[model samples]
Target: MKIKVINKGHHALPEYQTELSAGLDLRAVLSESKVLAPLERVLVPTGLYIELPQGYEAQVRPRSGLAFKHGLSVLNAPGTIDADYRGEIGVLLVNLSNEQFEVKDGERVAQLVIAKHETVEWEPVETLSDTERGAGGYGSTGKK
Candidate 1:
């Protein structure tokens, strides 16, 4: 599936893995080299914006290697990108380690997974069937 990408900044193009074992790679577009201090958050923007296919959504996730080594992660674990949105894909990354983290241009910042969505509909009902534990609060089964 070939998606159209519009590069809004002077940065490297976003690359996609041709094989199934890999995820769509997003690159970095930085105006100047900077470091993210411990527990500091930074907004990393992708040079390219895209239009995903209808009925499908793009899930923005953190890179496993970066998270494991640098203690960095996405603020929102899995950010959702609607198919209709045509803005630059911005990722909010937080540095959990007690060190300054530098993000260089063309570095893989995140990965995108294309997935389908199910439409939901709501209907008004007069009465509903009861379950084993009707309207039970948290831990209704009992705590040991």
Candidate 2:
């Protein structure tokens, strides 16, 4: 599906690194480098605004390499961008390691994944069906 986007940053539009990649890398748009101390979190702008079709949403996710190498991650993992939003894309990044991490202009900081979503309608019911694992949750099954 085609999407309408406006890029005001100095970097190219986000694109998938591989043919079968599900998400596109989103770059940071900053005038200068920004540093994040350990346990620090900041909202990094992408300078990208998008218009998604109804029943779809854009998800901002952390890059695995950054997370593994620098202990950096998205504060709100898989942050959702609703279809109706018209503002620039911003990523909430956090430093989990005990070191300072610097984010430079046009640096790949996050990934954007466009996905289809569904809305639910209320079906007020008095009772629900029963199952073997009816109310069991959170480690209900064996760890092994």
Tens-place lDDT per residue, model 1, 1-144, is 767778887766655666564567787888776588999998898866888888888888999889999988888979898999998898888899988899887778888888889877999899989997778889886644
Stretches > 4 Å off in candidate 1:
9-12, 126-144
Runs in model 2 lying further than 4 Å from the true structure? none
**Tell me, what's the RMSD of every candidate?**
3.0, 1.2
TM-score of 2: 0.97
Clashes of each: 0, 0
Local distance difference test, each candidate = 0.82, 0.96
Worst 10 residues of 2 by lDDT: 135-144
Give the range where candidate 1 is weakest over 10 consecutive residues by summed lDDT.
13-22
Q: What TM-score would each prediction reach against the true structure?
A: 0.80, 0.97
